[model samples]
Target: MPTRWELDKASIYSTKAGEKDRTYLDSAFCLTDDVSTPSRHEGRQVAIGKKVLQTLLTQLAGQGSALSRERTALVVATSWSDESYFVTGVSGKTDAPAGFTPGEQVAELAAAFALGGPALSVDTACSSFPYALDMAQALVNSGQADNAIVMALNTVLPPALFLGFS
Candidate 1:
């Protein structure tokens, strides 16, 4: 049987930097990545989520810590009804008629990471992040995984969001 990890809600927000856990105070928004790098995904296909997921994995990877590919889980919090218009002008984009569910989206992103842990996606509107945290916590607590990486993201901001700011 796998080890039952005692996880904290803020575990992903902090990292082990020496003897103590360092809490991150820096906040980032409106980030963009130049997709010039090769993807680690199997088949090395230049997919939509591969590059972004790789960029986000930097902090957890290469640390040589207890968290292994098999022990860590992945949870993505996004609206099920997120932007569907970005299908055009982008590669690896899937439209609504296709497998356009949040679960499938996260599953693809999870595949890019090549991790063997449990992976899932949650859509709870504004409460998504919190809901995702709960689901991630449950995954660890239930011995499904040792740890989890929670990403609250959207494919693209819908027009309604911009209109609200206007």
Candidate 2:
């Protein structure tokens, strides 16, 4: 299946050096809620999630041909929060703590395009976005959708989450 949501362009926005002790700011919007602080995951988590959705929407909108009124596009986003406690589990019952409510964020993004389709969030271990991309292609191949948006976002950090990757 061919990708309907072509990654024609992408960008990463980082905070000024040492702003947060050199921690990865990952997204333009940073999540202020404490991911591991038990009850402080809403603010930061939502901020990061919205920032991601906003970025994707912005990119898609930039694609004059991709944005159309007659074609619907599906959006799928993945995050590593499912494996990190820093985000906690209050955001939603996903495999991740900072995971955004699928319908809420997805719809928020889809609504931006005049021809948006169903929006979904998937937490497939480390391959969430790849799986979602496959699904999106399937949608387009099977005549279910004309376009798709798939993104993988992980901005927060948990010590154990990346113990061996360095």
Candidate 3:
């Protein structure tokens, strides 16, 4: 028999000005600077993803410091994966900068949240979120973790892609 899984809490941060909450999904037409940082390795997508993860984790951990515990897992899904889109296109660099891969982003989040469980990043374009959620569900159902944090991030930081499409 499969075990039952439940979502205790959720958070979302988008490029849109009014779509910070999931309830206002329709307000994500125009992209905005929801998560902008000056860090070299961190881009808009990573920043937003980190914010969402932190919010959800903080809610789950409460005031007792559940984040320090190792009973939770993190699964992130994104199309561009990391800051490669910006690094390669805008900077015209031939190599990816440090902490630009999907796996590295996961590691950074794990370290920041002090998560000790398994961390994975999935990239399947438009279907990445669903795939990540499925993976997280399996982890919980298999008794690998008591809770799982699933995140989906997408951003068009570099103007090349947007300009090209336009």
Instruction: State the C-alpha lDDT per candidate.
Output: 0.58, 0.52, 0.64
lDDT tens digits, residues 69-115, model 2?
35665655555442233445644666544434545545545665454
The candidate 1 region of ten consecutive residues with least summed lDDT is 37-46
lDDT of 3 by residue, 19-101 (tens): 33322224346444533543334354567677777787677668665654487888888777566434544443445354467
- Candidate 1 lDDT tens digits, 7-125: 34254233333323433434447544345632222112224456556766775565644357777889888763323323322335343233345666677677767767888888887
Model 1, TM vs. native:
0.59
Candidate 3 Cα errors over 4 Å, as ranges = 1-36, 39-42, 61-68, 84-99, 157-166
Candidate that scores best on TM-score: 3
Comparison by lDDT, 1 against 3, better one: 3
Candidate 1's C-alpha runs over 4 A off are 1-28, 33-49, 80-99, 161-166
Give TM per candidate: 0.59, 0.50, 0.63
Return the lDDT, model 3, position 140.
89
- True-structure lDDT of candidate 2: 0.52
Q: Global CA lDDT of candidate 1, please?
A: 0.58
Q: Please give the ranking of all candidate structures by lDDT, highest first, separated by commas.
A: 3, 1, 2
